[model samples]
Target: MVDLELGTLPKGRGPQLSYRLDRAVLGGGRDLKVPGSNTILDVAGLGDGVLATTLTADGSGELLKLNSAGAVVRRTPRIYTLVSASDQAAAAYASDAPLVDGQMTYGATLYSERGGSVQSVELPDVRSIKVMAYANGQVYYSASVKGSEKVAKLYSWRPGSSSRLVKTVPAPLAISPDGKLASSLPATGSDAGCSTVRGVTTGDRLFQSCEQTIGGFTPDGSVAIGTPANTDGNCAISVAALNVRSGAVIRQWRGCFYRVVAEDNDNLLMVALVSGGGQAPFSKSVLVRCAISTGACERATEITAAKEVDFAR
Candidate 1:
């Protein structure tokens, strides 16, 4: 069995609690005080250190680094709205603050983080950004129209230039690590029988899987989809992995998976709802690391009332 260490932090409180898991025994959760006045929006483990993004109650955000002791090492201002979901290093929303007026004008900012500072690069007019993926320093995103029909578009943004529409996807899109494959869901009006996975490089139709809706892509070009068995009320939820070239369902998991992150080749990290109720004050938010080959899932951690949370690599 793989060892696990689970950590928790209360809402509006800094990172103060940690739980250790060894074998089948779990140690008591402990609190480690840290200085900060922001809510922890996200946390990621990078190398031996930890990177955390926090948003203040005033809508300002910051990215911070911490050592193994839970002490702050560096902190930098991260002022962007609707940050990309795929890769944090590539693209972000145009405005540091949310827009008050309903006019649909916006841009995406691409940046490089060196040492502790971030240098900004600008992209073209793009709004309602959703997911972002990076490969070879290039950024890809799934965005949509701000109002009206609300159609989603897929674009690529490189440094020193504006974004180019790789494809105008009516549904959500996910890009592979090589930036060649784009697996997308079908449009609302299209037949809901199958999902399409397309190759952006050769304009070739790579693969198509039936009875599932494409959700996202893994870094290695593996496509993820939602199956018909998993549903939360009227909201459909399921997870599956598809081979990009063959368009075959290599592995699949049936459950209420709202958000998914491909942690590595053999593992996927997922945030799912508890069975108590579909609405808020949810039973609990669970984090699970599932083995791709065997579909065996081990409960890694849990959170309270977690809604609309995201995980990035």
Candidate 2:
């Protein structure tokens, strides 16, 4: 779950910027007030707890780990952008301009929640990194170079190990859990956002759709959630579940922009933007659980007057 601190302009005139943690399910949940947290960027299950990062309005960021009871167990100094997390550890990128041999370095570092040696990896000529999978001590990230648009690269590296280039997938790559199958948006001249699910190892195309954006891959790597490209223009954006093996659309949901926050073998946790009975700037958000077998959604929680929301799990 993502929490935001609502604050207005005019120098502390309205509500002050604060942060809270909440768990939303089909039935009920409670909000957890975190005293020092102002913004929550991402959260992931790390070992027996949750690992999260905060980016403040003052151009500062911090990585923190909270126990099962929502208490801060460990935290980094400052300026660390948390990237991805596995069961035993977490990875973060140094927000402070990192340089190796007087040249800028672009990569991520691994930190253990249990406290031990830190591992680091470096990639060249890429920025705006997005993590796809972090499991079994390996982290996979995708990014494009400054001027290149034809394809993007996915890199994989374990902690304290040298990085290896995985595959030059199409732009906006989404990989499966086992790192074998992937969905990528082709860089066509006009229909550039149209994506397809393909085999990363076999180079076989599984599925393709026009004007569709990849939401996420299922936990078991058998299905994927694909959303319409223009959610704002369309009255209702269709979120479709595509089977990776047979390249078929299994089920779908009609809603605004949806992000897959967490998933098990049978269900997906989605945060959706529902119309808040206002125009333009006025909007509302809600969290819901969507069943994988059937494309049914049960509203879990509604966020009241939130300006921004982000989730990681």
Q: Highest TM-score among the candidates is held by which one?
A: 2
Q: Pairing residues by index, what is the TM-score of model 1?
A: 0.65
Query: Per-residue lDDT of 1-313 in model 2, one digit per residue for the tens?
Result: 1111112111111111112233310111223333363666655554445556676666456766666566887777443444444233454343333455766445434333334345555555555566667655666666655566236676666767776666546564676765666777765566566777787767688777775666577767888777776666623355667777775777766655436533555565555666553234677765556666865556544454454544544
Pairs that clash in candidate 1: 16-32
lDDT of all the models against the reference? Answer: 0.53, 0.55
Among all candidates shown, the one with the greatest lDDT: 2
Candidate 1 lDDT by residue in tens digits, 1-313 = 2222223222222111122111111112222333475666555433334455667676656766665566888766644332333333333323232455745466545454423444565544555554355566666666654343366677666655666777534354556656767666667654554667787766677776666666566666665544553243733355676666776777776556556766656666666565544555454555566667776666656554544444533
Q: How many pairs of residues collide in each model?
A: 1, 0
TM-score of each: 0.65, 0.71
Our tally of clashes for model 2 stands at 0
Q: After aligning candidate 2 to the native by TM-score, how far in Å is the CA of 150 from where it should be?
A: 8.7
